[model samples]
Target: MSRTPDFLAQGHDERDPSPWLALYLDQSTPLPDEVKAAWLTDSSSGSRQYLLPFLRPVARLTIILIQVVKVFVPRNWSHSKLLHRLLAWGLKRFVSPEANWLILRHFHLGSQVLGFIGRNSPAPVGTSPLEPADIDALKDETFLKHDLNLFNFVIRLNQALRDKGLVLGKAPQVDFSMIRDPGLRLSDMPHGKLNFLDLQSAIELFTPLYQLMLTDNDFWRAANSLQLDETIGIYAATLLGAPEHLILVNNKHPLVPLSTLRAGHRLVIHGLSTEMLHSLLRRMQAAHGATPTPEQPLA
Candidate 1:
């Protein structure tokens, strides 16, 4: 027998293979002598042959269906009282004891064993971070999907703030020259950057203007305004359009519903303190029939 199995020799990262990989291995890779012997000993009462082909495509299909249901049904719907009752009835009537046993032992137990082995395995060394150019390229591709340019919006907002005679307590952390200059191309603008001060400045200027526009309030005549507050608000919520660094979900800030968070929706509460913001979030959640809990993740 070959000392190194094909599964082990596969050019996967030295770090643990995923749960899916483990399932694939369980089907393809031969079991160790100890494991087979243990299975034989455990199967004294029932014939071992009866439990043959435990890792079937049928089992995988069942698991996949469960995942699809979870994905299509929003979390709130799944947790609803009516759905809970239906789920209980469905599981009891539809799922058999033998099927349950197979799921518990063959699928769950095997996956747990694979997970343990993977966790204990050594990680690969010398993996470098993504290059700055690569990061910039990704950002540019992402930004192309949206209509507004975030950096330019920020620079325009700063000018609006100055015109309005609003003095920020601190100067913005982001340099606006690259974006403010019409001579520079989009590629020449700062890459993969998001300064909090710049973000706050954009929020400060854009949100109030947006809210006013939403209400159709009379402040539609400011001299230095770009007439693009709606555009700025739309892009600001996505702010960098990077999921890993989302700002709207921050616990300290108010959460905005993505569907309603676009350009024209009500997104601002002028002079709202941090405490007031959290209070408003709870009220909003309650009004929407979503139970508010401290541990619940921001939407």
Candidate 2:
């Protein structure tokens, strides 16, 4: 294949061809490798999608997933006992089996070129006198979603960062693959109500973790391309029942450090202050040094 030439322009003789070369590369609109890794990881996590070319193509799958999580989340779960104020804190609901399925289909997998804004976005209101009715109403309405919602929720913030000029770095220092199996297709899997319920409950717990990563713009913007790695390492085993494996980055590398990392969505561990990291590493090393590895039985 022919590549763009290194020749001089008609008007410009030897005036540093480097400037034009950089302009050409900077103008390239191809997706960054980090973004590509994120997408690939999300797909491995079991999101089902088939891209379509409808004129008004929307992220129906993600919307459906949000709706489904809304279903499982009991309303009033987030209301405080005193009920000092009412917040929109946009929370949607998933009402039935179908809604839940649709959500799973779109959950972690989909094109990155889309956004799923809920019907409402809650803002804090001034505190006021508490009321019994407010308490009852809150118990009856809001769900207990918390900061963990940041995972998949982060997609929104990444868009904001690009607008601010820091896009996924041209090359990510670290690499990762979102690893998973699709299980059997819906048509092939045996039908059992119990299994479905188990799946729903299990995912309900798992989705929140990914959603947390989605919200952590600070983490992503500062941490280089390891957001996906940290997300999986931190939450995979605990919330998803995946295997136990540790995920960590060492600050000792010459070219890599918290400051050199760019935030992706919101995860910020990569930008951890060096002093804090030293303290943490000391603790880890101390623990490891104290524990003796088990020896194989004499053969």
Candidate 3:
């Protein structure tokens, strides 16, 4: 059999992949094989496949209910402190600790991705130098209500863990700072709305729903603010040394309600596991130069 091309291999004329992919594939920061296997299994599990039939109707109903609510409540009220507080209350009371840890771990991974992009990009094409303060700014309500949700989830999860005689080795922290906006916008890029016909675009559009749940908004906004799309474009064109396949473009994709519901259920069901959560925290801690405590485990 012909050897599979290394998409991440540098100096290759035909394949150039994102450095962010390297973060997951590199030997120095190895992801556990079992965790990867679990992700694959969860993606195609029977539970997820069977649940889709029930979830589809519920998802359609949810869209209708949301539209009805929007008519009664102004869009601004969606971000109101009152509504946030209520949501926070519900999350605290109802969401599993495993899910909260998974949610927070995503922010940490996002910070690492953005930070890697910022620090590695060539001069004149990179983001402004990020600082500790810039990372902290991610938690401010003005910047993203989702970050506040992150904080709330962290506190509640930690408390729950403590009650169960477990502790997270490290709480999620942003490691990069942006002194100023990178001024890149997806709207300015040649990208189009996601197109379901393109498999990659379709996956990108729906992956966020399962991975970040309700917290993806701020990450995307932060990505735009940091000019990640543009910066990645530069890396694709200049750094990865391939532009033909590496350049980013927005694609339009139609959302099939049934497909979305199935994808969401599949991802959420298999997304969280004690091993995966702990492994992620350890990876984050290692990236930040902290020692991973072996005894620390998620509840």
Candidate 4:
């Protein structure tokens, strides 16, 4: 077989590829604004103007990198909408994964990963991180569709790993929750008056034994918060369809549900602290069928 592989050796006008190669290998080329324009075309509505803010930090440098050298350009090189993508792409292609383990030299991997899962930041793989506020501002369907993208990545990676004989059958860790909004009848679910139906509405959004939690007055008890939390918890447990022993559950921070507990419609709690649980039961005791008004400001 001839030494040069067919893939790399293409282009018949090979008057020595080396001299011609200087065109791309050169440094000091200028990065440009038009490149940004090329990328902005596809952004949703005014995403360009909104994304412009994050793009500024590395715009000039990225313009230079994108044009000047292959080593500098990110592997997924679409145009530079912002510096982060430039960094994400350049690092992924230029650096060897074998050497860097995801080329995470400058990033806090754990924090970024958490932000992706909870904050709804960072679409999987090549996508840029969205601002947390931006995420919340998104319509529920858009945000969740983005979230499922991340979930799919996890599932695929695990399948790849197992196929390679790496030997692990565990599905990725996940959490589920059912949270009651605070109010008369909203947050106040007495044992007898529980709205297992609406809870199912949320649960159906995420389902079937992945993991679960319930947030009650303990987490977001504005004051006189209702005690319908356990009712939600039991409801979630029933939805999980697991024997009690295998039902992974918790109620920490009651506000910020644990990271592992996400990927399901799990209740978000303010905290699972004793103060939270006590405050919840106290509200329950004070209830008189009519909901008590919440009085304390959140600490």
Candidate 5:
């Protein structure tokens, strides 16, 4: 626990941790500077710049259509079982395995990030473990709405890693009995609703929409960048009492106003905030050895 675990460090180079651990662990430079650098670096390398001109109009139109549809259609329509099955069928039949791999890998990485924070922090920051029933429900929902094949692939991959004596972090664990808000489940949040339209869901939905416009690699990289933004919002929700702030619509840094910008301003800010809060929590725990009470249930 004193240093980054070996498994997480496997592919990472200590000298330059640009994409993954830099935002999480590095505290030497001002985070805003790091974020600017990370943003510019990602923007310079990816296919995003090439496709942006073509995709921007389509993306904008899609957003307009969604907004229009929201007026006529009931919000619950997003959760229609029939619609999910149709989408799932298309994804399974049409989505390339390579793209699916990238999609599923993001979830694994997100879980690792959460687990690391949980284990390293003094108090449980985001340790709401899904129950067995919840897990089953998620599997069923994912199979219907997301890519089940990719889910199974990752499951096998994780097992293979375990068989080889490699240990990757699993979801965070905490004693629910000792927590004040034990009922804090993702389903209770507005953005977490099965029927809600949010950035994470939008990114998944975009996979099918942009499949023709982008190569699998291009799509994955673009989607991963956006997901990183969502991940920052998630960190805010867990640590800062703001669950609905899980998208980048208005959270973009002020100095850079271009819609085409793909930096991690919000990501770096919230990430550093989470780390600082963890430090405070560690000190609190050291001084008192008592569980800090949960903030008032997120409204």
Candidate 6:
């Protein structure tokens, strides 16, 4: 491919070139600062769309039906805590072990990403970075120790619900050793590698973490792209299960799903892409004093 000077020009609209293409191009030659600014401005203008086009009609009809059904149902049916608890109880009765395992894995991945940030992020003048020996040690020391640890905390939470007559199936035991540390937002890992997450799993795992961190507007303001990407891969695993597909990054490829590019879609990762992973690997390798090689680069 031949490179052109104006292709990397300032004030270029990223969306015009399409996000996927823009990302790949931005890799070898970073876009001008003005181009990024303009791109972000344009991308951020859309409304949040949580449902698919087909689902929107179904959802509306379901809501209307619910309203109609409510007229005949007892008023207490909607507001009753006991009724809600009963529903939860029934739901748990159907919680398969596979479902429990999937939930545990996602939470475990989330915790690992958070722990990586806590350990590697710079500390304040009076403080030091958290340095846990391993996942267990990390679990014991982190704030999420009480609520986020899948084996201990989440298990306990499920037990508590069970104690209250909720029927949630037991959270499956997850092996934390399988979880890989996503080094930095800019770190890169080869797709064939063990730690790499494909598009679907990437989106599923990060969506909740993104919401959790961005819940507070102040924290959202403080967060950077690296934090977002690294936490999500914008965050995935080896032992539990592999991603459904090998993620690709072409706009016109029939194998690639266009719905992934839409905001709030199940596969949306905003701008998080392979570029972030590559940058992260380089940064982390340098931090650990490991020399990068083509055969074994990145974390």
Model 5, residue 207: distance off in Å is 7.3
From the highest TM-score down, the ranking of the candidates is 3, 5, 6, 4, 2, 1
Per-model lDDT: 0.27, 0.27, 0.33, 0.26, 0.35, 0.31
Best-performing candidate as measured by TM-score: 3
lDDT by residue (tens digit), candidate 2, 49-90: 221122112322343454457556654333232221221111
Clashes per model (N, Cα, C within 3 A): 0, 46, 13, 20, 0, 11
lDDT by residue for model 1 (148-230), tens? 23223345445655676653232222111111101112222222212111212222233332322221111121211222323
> Which candidate leads the pack in lDDT?
5
Kindly list the per-residue Cα lDDT of model 5 for residues 161-221, writing each as its tens digit. 5666654332243221122212223322222113222222233344344432333333333
Residue by residue across 24-73, what tens digits does model 4's lDDT show? Answer: 23322211122111111212113233543443334334433433454453
TM-score: model 6 vs. ground truth = 0.25
Q: Work out the TM-score per prediction.
A: 0.17, 0.18, 0.36, 0.19, 0.33, 0.25
> Mind giving the per-residue lDDT tens digits that candidate 6 earns over 115-196?
3322222220111222333223322323232122323322343455556664322113322221243332111112121322
* Cα displacement (Å) at residue 263, model 3: 10
TM-score of 5: 0.33
Deviation in Å, model 6, residue 142 alpha carbon: 16
| Candidate 3 accuracy as lDDT | 0.33
lDDT of 1: 0.27
Off by over 4 Å in 4: 1-111, 114-130, 135-137, 167-265, 269-299
